[model samples]
Target: MGIFQRLMKNKELIPLAIIMTTAVAGASSFALYAFQKTDVVIDRKRNPEPWEMVDPTQPQKLITINQQWKPVEELQKVRRATR
Candidate 1:
């Protein structure tokens, strides 16, 4: 008999055979993908430009406040009073 006729003859083995086949296919595909080199180019050891380097001793001024803003103590007092 042919392979198909032999497979159908063993009813209990059909599910097991299908499961094994699927597992093998999935594993092979995953292995192929994992072993292949990635398309993305990554530069792990890139050097910063001379201008980009900053002195640790000198602090960088990100923002300058022209006027002194009032504290949130007033809002906190109002919330506490409501509670």
Candidate 2:
């Protein structure tokens, strides 16, 4: 007969059909959520900060610190001499 009638004849298949239906629905929902793209918009004009007002096209000067480098052999010699 119909599918519903077949399922009604076999009562044990009800739980199996419910579990399969739930699994299929869960998988479809997860696939839709995973592949959806979300757009983010930022408004900088409402209340702008000092850093946000700076021109992005202009080059900014960076502060540099002077540091001396020593070779690994020299560092090992210094450590051994100290001991």
After aligning candidate 1 to the native by TM-score, how far in Å is the CA of 70 from where it should be? 38
Task: Report the C-alpha displacement of residue 6, candidate 1, in angstroms.
Answer: 1.3
Tens-place lDDT per residue, model 1, 1-83, is 97678888988878888999999999999778654423222333563333234343343344645645454788779868988
Q: What 10-residue stretch in candidate 1 is worst by lDDT?
A: 35-44
Candidate 2 per-residue lDDT over residues 12-53, each given as its tens digit: 999999999999999999677654422111444664544535
TM-score of each: 0.41, 0.43
What's the TM for model 2?
0.43
Best by TM-score: 2
**Residue 41 in model 2: lDDT:** 19
Candidate 1 colliding pairs: none
Q: CA shift at 35, candidate 2, in angstroms?
A: 0.9
lDDT of 2: 0.64
